[model samples]
Target: MEPTLPMPAAPSSIHFHANCTPTNYSTSPPNSWPPFPLAPAREISSYLNHSRHLSKSKPLPSLASSSQPRTLCFVAMEKKFVEEAGCCYYGGDVDVDGEGRATALRPAALSRPHTQAFHLAWLSLFACFFAAFAAPPILPALRPALVLSPSDSSAAAVASLAATLVGRLAMGPACDILGPRRASGAASLACALALALAAVFASSPRGFLALRFAAGLSLANFVANQHWMSRIFAPSAVGLANAVAAGWANVGSAAAQVVMPVAYDAVALRLGVPVTVAWRVTYLLPCALLVTTGLAVLAFPYDDLEGNRSAAAAAGGGNRSNTLWAVVRGGVGDYRAWVLGLTYGYCYGVELIMENVAAEFFGRRFRLPMEAAGAAAACFGAMNAAARPAGGVASDEVARRFGMRGRLWALWAVQTAGAALCVLVGRMGAAESPSLAATMAAMVACAAFVQAASGLTFGIVPFVSKRSLGVVSGMTASGGALGAIVTNRLFFSGSRYTVEEAISCTGITSLICTLPVALIYFPRQGGMFCGPSATVDDDDNDDGDVGANDDYMLLK
Candidate 1:
């Protein structure tokens, strides 16, 4: 006879069904049985019969036996019974089955407010990006209307990007200090006001530049968008969630490229308006959209790290400046954050440059018609709809498979491929009979890889420092703007180097950046930088009394 094992206490979090049926059992004598607190005698008999069948040739081992074979047999039987019964034995935290098969865990349904908050965050970003990039599509109309020189027009084109860099630098800390909801609404309102002013009285080139620079502040909305998504989604799903929010918002730039021309034509043809009037009026559509999104953000419920309003208020109320400084100091001090930021600068920075230059580059390199070159250039922007999200999905898959290391690996792999594609594009540009089709294909491929790299870079941003997610995201985003500035200077600086040489330089720079990315080491259990020490108080309270009170409240 087998010794009776003591019944293990059931975890309170698990719910066992009262109507659970026992497995069919043959009429065989059992040796030993483990005690189950709630299981009926017939259920115990069924488990014993199953275990006996599993150990067919070898007799059942006594539970008290010191033999290795007997211990292995006992564990195997217990595991088998657990699997057959479909009981979750590892509390409710684990998502694996008893047989060691990985089970997909379904996320809890989101509350209505949470759902609305998420949609609002993305829509706000979309409106901001739409307004910020609106200048590029309307540049042609503006050039003739404002009597802008080529240099003035060039400056106008990059005004938003330059302004966005400053905005991101400022707004990152703002989002951390103020909640995402408030920050997003404020940014939208500012952008809408800038656009409205430009539409009503933007007669001079200088006026247009000033208005665009101010409107470019809307780009800061990206930081808030990521912060809000991080608060809403779990770490496992945050990558994809961030990707979706960013990817869709990014589509606004492409939408502007498409919509601006159509809107420009529609106003002129339908209303018999002059080309200048049509161009100025088209800005109103995005302006109205921006105002609506801003109001939505203001009206919607705000989400915080803890997803509790009282907790968020308590955390955000006092020491707001201290919290902002702490977040900035921590983000800046981390070497991994800097490396990621520079890497992002290369991928996304180059993307910004390409957006403005692609049409010109294709037009000059292949001797294509202006319209054809513009169409080819537009292809790169259009790929954002699918490519950016794909990068996030890939990062999630790699992280799921290999943890933190896998995320970095995915970023490096995509960036490396993107660099190679960049070189291919440059070489194609110099070919004797460069096929427009071939050049466009390489350009699209390059865009996809770069945008995907941007997605992967952000995939690690929120993980670097949860408390400083806004700062980290902002710094990384600013890297893209810096990269665009550098690349644009290289291409347009009127040096002896040809455009192909400049293009190849970007690829080479990207390759050099990949080395540092490989060296970044994230802890297995703690935050990205050091270990547990890297994790600071999420709510920055310098006072010990308040910290204690917050801890007590959280526990309660």
Candidate 2:
């Protein structure tokens, strides 16, 4: 007889089912993947037989409709990925004879929303980074009038921190119950009230403390803001949205630094309003903005996760009943969330100190009076406004080309360089009264790096979560709050005017700790770096819902 093909062992067991456990599936036609250009038509066409001619407008049959394993893989990849992955998951295994290749007999989850909620979430999250000025940077202008020491003025700082913690803890669960829409309204209402109260009761320290706490508690609007933004946009648009938000947040910070001071001076210089009265400007404007945002969102028609639904409808629409606790508990246990949170906290702590207490640091270190130092400190504050967007843009382009692997490494390297340079900026400005231009330039550079780092820090978040942007942001911001607590101590706030020591002590420390964190969390590349990227494939459905990558990326 002519040479015969070798026989291979059959599967331990086999059975045909009416439907897969998870859901129905359609018979995938040949060359089913769109464009037909990315993949050869013959390979897929042969697998589907003649079913490939179905019209594009026709509703796709569910995987549940298919009886064959190959058809189901093509039709129900999203649902079957995890829902059908039972412990005894395998139904069949292809064991090829000597020269033939083997293939898995089990279903696998599909990858979608590669950068979905991330970009949108980043913008809203970045806004918090900048909005912090209403609470922190503005507090200093009130000090001279309040007759409080610069160090003790941090009381408003501490209250806001505590309130922010409250807002975060509360808003997260609220997002689950109230939905993003309700939560945003409630949070903004609170924020507006808090700011108004602070401004109205400018003369009362006790009232001021209470309002500061309220403002912190009110910021929960931010979480809901992020969720809403993420829900509205598609995956591909995520990077750009986040980049813009990152830039705007710095703008908010810059506005706080530069504008608030001028406003304060307006009342003090023009109207004989002392620091307390001048500080009213800081408290009033945020209140107006909060109320306006709250009202506007309430009036608009809301749609969370409506984009690119045709590719994956089931995953795109938001579940009316999804809870925030589900998101938090699900992600808090995640290792990646914690690791990224660490990096955020470390770098953010430094940034917060610069934005909030730099006036004091500059005042004490150089013995410049409070207002002048506060004025000059705007250099960092202003640089941050422009630098953050640039960072986001840079990160976007880099990630698109080299993938997350190259982008993350670059982010850390830049941060490390910037932090080290802070030392130089400080040393140059320390002890000596250099030309005003040089001193301002150094301060601007420091600020630029600070804001630039702010943008870069958020750049990694897309790689962190697929389904749980709210939770991930919460964890990172919460950690950042804790970091703020540590750095806000009196010793760190000492207004000694030596630029070099402050830079070495503050700037360098932030760099050292965050660098390691950036390295650790960055997606691993080719065994060189280990990241969740291995688990997250490049298959964006453009839908709001996440698929398999949700599990791995959510926590770790």
Candidate 3:
């Protein structure tokens, strides 16, 4: 096929200040102002509908890019208002039209097109990665600090686990009701604050558990952030852009290998090992880092062209129950939502099971020290995190080369192969030295390859139904939760099976059952991820016109 075409260049080439001021600032002496390039096409087209609301009587705020700091330019398309043309590198003013948008302000100092959106999406994914690592590694450090026996610790931690499960379940509805952009920003902030507080006050399992629960709530960011990007970028760019984000997220997971160890050491030094200090510090530091990133999200800049579904549609929310039923009953009463959700869940389930249980498997089967085993365990989580983002980008390239449908099949084929390798690992566990080495190698390779599937699973979600991105996300996450818990719970086979054996078995099963589901759900001839050239409004109008102009209407 033709070389994968790059997404269109953003609206502006010149870097300029984009101060987002309400139409009528308190008539106060304006913060320092400067001159710059006019609005980029993105700045104009993204928000046509929102601009109408900006002013029914006045020409929408003149669009101009500013190089100097504190430069302000407002654009309103159909009354959806973005006072700033560019994105903010750091956090600043933000009043989202809905919960679906993960939009942020761009620092007037920076002018790379779609830079703000890309940066925020990456950070959001990073924050999600942060939580992913924190829970598993910090469990040990936290236990002594909380002064709980294993049983008590489990009880307290259960809430956090529940929070993630429930949060995933709830996230989609919130996004559908509120919108992806808004939901993501809110979830990110909520997570940051919860983690921060837990860090400072966590003396017992209960306190930290609460914090974990809060942090888990932010997992919504994974779904919402991707949706936010889909809103901002055209369909063609989404695959590559999301791949980068997902890959970097996994990188964050990989980095956590280093971070978690250092964090454990740092806290132990100050608070002493086997005490609560290390755990508190470990949890607390992420709070600061992630919150700071969340703030940056709040301060991210606008693309001027992208639009949100919720606020645009009267800021009215959806009936989550109905929406969810729709997904289960077949999306819009068809196969769209469940198929994608199942595929994503199946893939997510396989990867997370391995990452979540690796330490237990290795420590028990191989009899390694906790930390040593965990170090190896971190490899899988690290791989999964990095792979998701990179895979997203790779999927996009595949889509560009072969069509979006090809990306789906490609990811499925890879994940299936990885799962097959996992089976090989388990079977070889009781075999010769060659068997063990081969299995281990397979585990590592699958660890990395599976993420591409994960990335594609999520990257494709938003476009399935621009309006239902959140619900779609929630359903997929819900499926993920089921897959994660069910697959792992089977390991509870009281002395029935070894951990590695269980994992290997689940891996094979997921590939066997879910991979085909993905393929069948996304048939060969259909589109997987797509967005119209015009905004949702344009689509609505076109439909309306067709209805009005239908020749059959002559009788009416």
Compare the candidates by lDDT and give the number of the best one. Answer: 1
Clashing residue pair totals per candidate (backbone < 3 A): 2, 31, 71
Full candidate order by TM-score, most accurate first: 1, 3, 2
Q: Estimated TM-score per prediction?
A: 0.73, 0.65, 0.69
Tens digits of per-residue lDDT, candidate 1, 17-37, equal 211112211122233433233
The runs of at least 3 residues in candidate 3 whose Cα sits more than 4 Å from the true structure, single-residue gaps closed, are 1-113, 145-161, 176-181, 196-211, 270-274, 303-334, 384-386, 429-439, 492-494, 515-556
User: Candidate 1: what lDDT?
Assistant: 0.65
Local distance difference test scores for all models: 0.65, 0.50, 0.55
The candidates, ranked best first by lDDT, are 1, 3, 2
List, residue by residue over 1-556, the lDDT tens digit for candidate 3: 1111112333443232233344331122233433233353334334322443443344323434433333222322112223444322211233222111223322231323355566767777677667655665556566666765644544443454456678776766665556655666677777777677766876776776676577656665666666556555455555655566656665665555457766777667755755545566566666666767777766654422333344223211343433444432333343566776666666766765666556656666677665676777777766755566666666666766666566667777767776776676677664534343465677788777667677777656645554454566667666665666666556534457666567677766767755454443332234435322332331242212112211111100
Lowest summed lDDT window (length 10), candidate 1:
18-27
Off by over 4 Å in 2: 1-141, 176-181, 202-205, 217-222, 268-282, 307-324, 361-375, 434-436, 490-500, 518-556
